[model samples]
Target: MRRRVPNEVGIAAVVVLVAIVLSVLSPNFRTIENAQVLLLNGAVIAFLALGQTFVLLTGGIDLSTGSNIALTGMIAALATSAGLPWYVAVIAAIAIGLVVGSLNGSLIAYLKLPPFIVTFATFGVAASIPLILTGASSVNVRDPFFAIIGRGALFGIPMPVVLVAVAAIVFSVVLRFTSTGVHIYAVGGNAETSRLAGVRSARVIVLAYALSGLCAAMGGLIVTSRLMVGYPSAGSGNELFYSIAAAVVGGVSLFGGIGSIGGALLGAMLIATVSNGMNVIGVESYWQPLVIGVIILVGVVLDTHRRRISLATLLSRFRGPREAAAAAPTS
Candidate 1:
């Protein structure tokens, strides 16, 4: 078998290549301000991608993330408009995610429903909820505190970027060092095996979904703060597609049991770079979807190949030196 580049390294190379190409194509793209914008833009998707990574790790998917964002953003906006404190609105928004995630976890864990179908159905229900509550109108957020979460800068870095970094650090620790993290991987790798080993598959699955929801809530809040408005269609379809794509591209396997938050962030950066570059270069809006689709297709193909390579490597290790000597010719 040919030597293969590590997933993160390959992705990082792609990021660098894309940045170079964009820099050449658009003189403005190389500026520090633009770099800041790229990071900020990527941060929102990165947040959702991180959550998706957790769910995907458990061999599950959360199709409602975007819808959850819409619902939570609307809740935050409405709360602030009703004279509630900004912090309180923020809490309320996150609560919406927790409730939705808990519901999804309960149904999937207890009822034995397919994760795909459960999340898919919830996507529809969650998307419609914001409209029901707001009568399909956009609610503007006038709170300065709410605005700061999106626009404020700390130590010369955007708030959104800082939050994303902090989240990545926390998740890295959780997934790498904690027993719950190991159990999550175990469940995704093989539920029966994990159960036999005394891991509570149901609770782990629930926790994964709950974390996904919390991430969605955080994403929605930042979006609302940035736009200074709570529109039911805010995250729209982008949340579901981008989050999953970023995670997958970052090295999170669709089949589950393998991936990292850092990888997902790199994936988000790649996608964000493409988007911002295309916009800066004045690519037609109609072609954007096609480009994103093609990139995702390529990423999926790469992931498949990576899996094959892993399997081959494992099988080769099992074929010991004695077997190899037996197969060799005596010259």
Candidate 2:
């Protein structure tokens, strides 16, 4: 039997190779300060990708997560400015995420709405709410303690980085070791079959979207805290794109039910490195999207090919035994 290497190992190798090449090309890329900055900037994308992993595992998508950041972050900023305790404000923001996520889940899971349509509609709604509330202005976060969530460090690591690291570990464990994880994969693999086999596909789907919403809220907090302002346009830009790209590039299938937290994290690192390396090398910012788009296209193509190969192999196995039995000559 041939041993197969995990996709994560290949992605990790690519990350290391890229880092080495960038360091050699750009002296500044090798500095500790640059490394810290890269990680900090990548934190938001990593968090979004983590949540996206859960949803993707359940054969779903979350177009609203980017807008959810703007909505939740603005809410937190407003609550704090209105004299609520920072903790309370944070809680309120998270609650809003849960509500939005639940709404998305209910529509898709219970109402049988398409995931794309539901999330796309909510994306517009979520993005619009913050803009309307602020009258197209950014809200300043006056609470000093709020800064810790994004800027404060623990044992020399940036707070956002530390938070994401913890989240990744927890989510990885949940996906790898829990029965809920099995249900999630089952639902993604074949929703109808899973339902027939006694799995509550609807509930599992809702949970996945809800978790994605929670992660979006966390991303909102970090971005708002780092800037000390809740920009109405926060996360409305490249965030959603980067998140999807990271997950797909990390080996998460577009068809779902096949991916890992570690792989997504490595994908995030690869993206962050490319973005940072480009900036360091003085490449025009306009070219960044082009590069990322190519990466995404390549990932999708590979995923499609892999799926085809797996299907072919499975068909061969199923036909092999039947063919052998037929050749045995029945009495």
Candidate 3:
């Protein structure tokens, strides 16, 4: 039998190939400083992608993550301006994310609502809250310590990058080794079957969305800390798009129950690298989205193809036994 290569290996190779091409095309793209900047810029998307992975694993999507970032950041800024300690503000922001995620999960899991509708409604609501609360104005963050979360470095790596790395590691372990993680995969693979097998599908779904919300909150913190302000329009741009694109490109199946945190991170890095390289090479800003859209379409097509092939292979394996038994003179 021929060995099949992992999806991650293929994506990683593509990332390296793209990086090499960019390095050759643009002298500045090869610099260490540029590399650090690229990683830093990609950190927020990475966080969102990580969170999306959990939700996606359960055959669900969270469109509210980008809006969650805006809402959470605004909340943190407002809390800071109202004389709350930085840590307190952080907690407040994270708490809001949990609440929103829980709400989304509850509606989908208990009410049997579609994940798309629930999260899309959440997206609108979360996005609107920041604008309404701040009256469409940016809230300034006066706490200097709050900046550390975004700007501080550990062992020469950017703080955001370090934080994402830590998060990826922790989550990777949990998904691979924990019962909750197994439940998440089972739920995503087949919710009805999992439920019949005694898995708490509803609870698993809720936890997935909650984890996604937590990740969005972390992204919000980094963005707010770096800017030292809570702009009501924050995360209203390409963040949500880029996050989904990154996850898809990283081998996460849109249908659910497939993908890894490591692959998602690689996908994030590829996106960041492409964006930065384009900027360095003077590609028009308007064209960047076009390129990313193409990437997304390709990822989706590939995912579908892989699924079909796997399904066919499984069917053939099952048929092999039946066909051989029938041909054995009814033995």
TM-score of each: 0.93, 0.98, 0.97
Ranking by lDDT: 3, 2, 1
What is the alpha-carbon RMSD of candidate 2 to the true structure?
Answer: 1.1
RMSD of each: 3.0, 1.1, 1.2
Model 2 lDDT at residue 147: 92
Model 3: CA > 4 A from native = 1-3
Stretches of candidate 2 off by over 4 Å are none
Q: Least accurate stretch of 10 residues (summed lDDT) in model 3?
A: 322-331
Look at candidate 1 and tell me the lDDT of residue 305: 90
Candidate 3 lDDT tens digits, 192-219: 8999999999899999999999999999
Identify the runs in model 1 with alpha carbons over 4 angstroms from their true place: 1-5, 319-331
Q: In angstroms, how far off is 159's CA in candidate 2?
A: 1.2
- The TM-score, computed over Cα atoms with residue i paired to residue i, of candidate 2 is 0.98
Assess each prediction's global lDDT (C-alpha) against the native.
0.90, 0.92, 0.93
lDDT (Cα) of model 2: 0.92
Query: What tens digits encode model 1's per-residue C-alpha lDDT throughout 1-331?
Result: 9986667998899999999999999999999988888887788899999999999999998998999999999999999999998999999999999889888888998899999999999999999999999899999886778988889889988999999999999999999999999999999998899999999999998999999999999999999999989999977855678888889989998888999888999999998898889988999877777878887788779878978998998888888776988999998
Model 3, residue pairs in steric clash: none
